[model samples]
Target chain A: MASALINVPAKAKRGDIIEIKTLMSHIMESGYRHKASGEAVPRDIITSFTCHFNGAEIFRADLFPAIAANPFFSFFTTATESGKFEFEWIGDKGFSETASASISVE
Target chain B: MRFLGAIATALLVVGAVGAAEIPLAERRSGYSFMKPDTKTMQDDDTANPGMLWVLNGETLWNRKTSAADKACADCHGNARASMKGVAARYPAFDKATGRPIDLEQRINSCRTNHQQATPLPFESRELLSLTAFVARQSQGAPIETGADPQLAPFVAKGRELYMQRQGQLNLGCANCHDDNWDKRLAGAAITQGHPTGYPLYRLEWQSLGSLQRRLRACITGIRAQAHDYGAPELVELELYLMSRARGMAMEAPAVRP
Candidate 1:
């Protein structure tokens, strides 16, 4: 099973540009690699990541084979109002993990 | 030039002159040699991947096993209080084996004797998780090994191995780490070999690893035969390293490139 760590501030001023950081555990193995026996090691990587604020998409990123293992994502989003931030990551082999954090804009 | 000659002749000089030891004030942790960004990654829990293993370990510590039907927490209770500074004191002398054992061996011993569970394989994710979890509890605690009189012989043996030259390259660990540290090697800085961190996140491996793994890699890099995991030689080496790095703060789960 995979694990993830996410950091989102709990509070921010209205219209503040907030930073969100997410790190997910995945081998992100590039298919180009091979085993000691000359056989190819299967490629596995997180293909996409998206963030939603109050059900509206705030951020999205498409990943590729070259991404490092345990890919980390950091981006900015303007804090418009008090709401929840939802995160989702999807990848090969039907892999998916989601987490949510709430924010209060004062 | 004389220093370079001495390193080239390290094999002959190993049993003669005592290994040139680094001064305490001059010592620097591997963390000190890392880039600003790499250090930033390590300082932020949200960014460091080793934290993932630490998270898994916390779960494993609480979950009940199949055979013993007991979790580690059942016996040790809250790890925060019970495990603090524990990792700093290994590789500890085990009278039962009449040798020193590292933290990984001690973890497996607990599983075999008390938890009735099969030992996790070396370098396995599960084992790394548990060891990282235990060691994380000792973050910032200074290493306190080598005080025990019983471990004198093993520590001596370890020092021998560290200073002896072998493999096709014919290099001892001291040649680069002790003799030429702060110098660049193939674009990477040579760090003084301090066992301050283990089960750390290495960018090269893209995974968490133990000191033994790093040692084996170093040995193989010089074209020498590597010791098997959990070998007494490795444990003894770990002992001597901990002793040599005495009072250095623990930084397991550190991120390094």
Candidate 2:
């Protein structure tokens, strides 16, 4: 697991368009290699990513092996209310991450 | 005649002193973490899966992909001739893009633009093989990069990044690979940082990985915020690493532990 950066607009007007960006560092092994002991390096990758606002799903995506080691994603949403935005990444090997940021609607 | 002889003797003495002050050639080989690691995995018996890509790359070099096109052989003639001394010059500063492009990027560009083929996805076998094939062309030529004006700033940034402390450990790349290269870390021998041989088959990785990938691993090992692939910061770091290996022979597709 590598570090990640999540950025969202500091503030947004009611019904205004808001943007969010995220980047994560991961080896994203394609299950194509072996271990130091000459055994196979099992394939492990972040299979899914999702974002929620105020406990409601806002965006989601599926990832493929072709994606680079460190993945970056950006998306836009309409702001209708103020609350918290939660981000999660699910991967093989039972790897999971959750990050959150507070949002305020003007 | 006496005055002329006296002047010649003085000049000879000065030249002798200057020569004496200069260190021996062996000491001028630049910085290196050349200490032998008893645990270093250097043989194929370790059996990294990445070696598969090199084999695949060899096939791709000879396999003709298009009707209008011939294999790499059609254009380059022979790997020994057309490819020789090429890898040593890469991660080159492309005047058109005004940025340093690594060998992987360059090979993809050539395939898309010239070979009339779709570019391979990053980290794919096709991309790895193509890169390995091209890199093998310059097996012995010394690395010679950073002469381009556009590359100077990138190299500078890379050097700065390499030395800057980061993460919870508060360690910089230089701390382990430079200052304490001869020391042990968690019972592992700290090797010198060198990019002369890359896309190397690492026993630890059990695969072949690019230098940038290795850089990302190092950052993660220290719990730092690693930059994404193709990120400006990573590119700059790559530039710095390559520059440090300037004049060293290219050893791409080299096997390592």
Interface RMSD of 2: 13.2
TM-score of each: 0.94, 0.58
Q: Which ranges of candidate 2 are over 4 A from the true structure?
A: A1-106, B1-52, B66-70
Q: What does candidate 2's lDDT look like per residue over B1-257, in tens digits?
A: 57645533443343333211112232122113333341222222122233345556767887777544757667777676887887787778876688888888887677766788777776676777778777767777888877677788888988889877787555677666555445454555566676776777665664567878889999987778888877778878888877776777776666555
Q: What does candidate 2's lDDT look like per residue over A1-106, in tens digits? A: 2446667877889999887877664668888778889998888889999999998999999998767554567799998988999999999889898888888898
Clashing pairs in 2: A31-A43, A34-A41
Instruction: State how far residue B31 of model 1 sits from its true place (Å).
Output: 0.8
Q: Which candidate achieves the best TM-score against the true structure? A: 1
Local distance difference test, candidate 1: 0.89
Residues A1-106 of candidate 1 have per-residue lDDT tens digits of 4988989999999999999999999999899999999999998889999999899998999999988899999899888899998999999989999999999999
Listed per model in order, the count of residue pairs whose N, CA or C atoms clash below 3 Å is 0, 2
**Model-by-model DockQ, in order:** 0.90, 0.01
Any idea what lDDT model 2 has? 0.69
Summarize candidate 1's per-residue lDDT along B123-231 as a digit string, tens digits: 9998999999999999999999988999999999998888888887677787777777767665688899898878899999999999999999998977799999998
DockQ, computed on Cα atoms, for candidate 1: 0.90
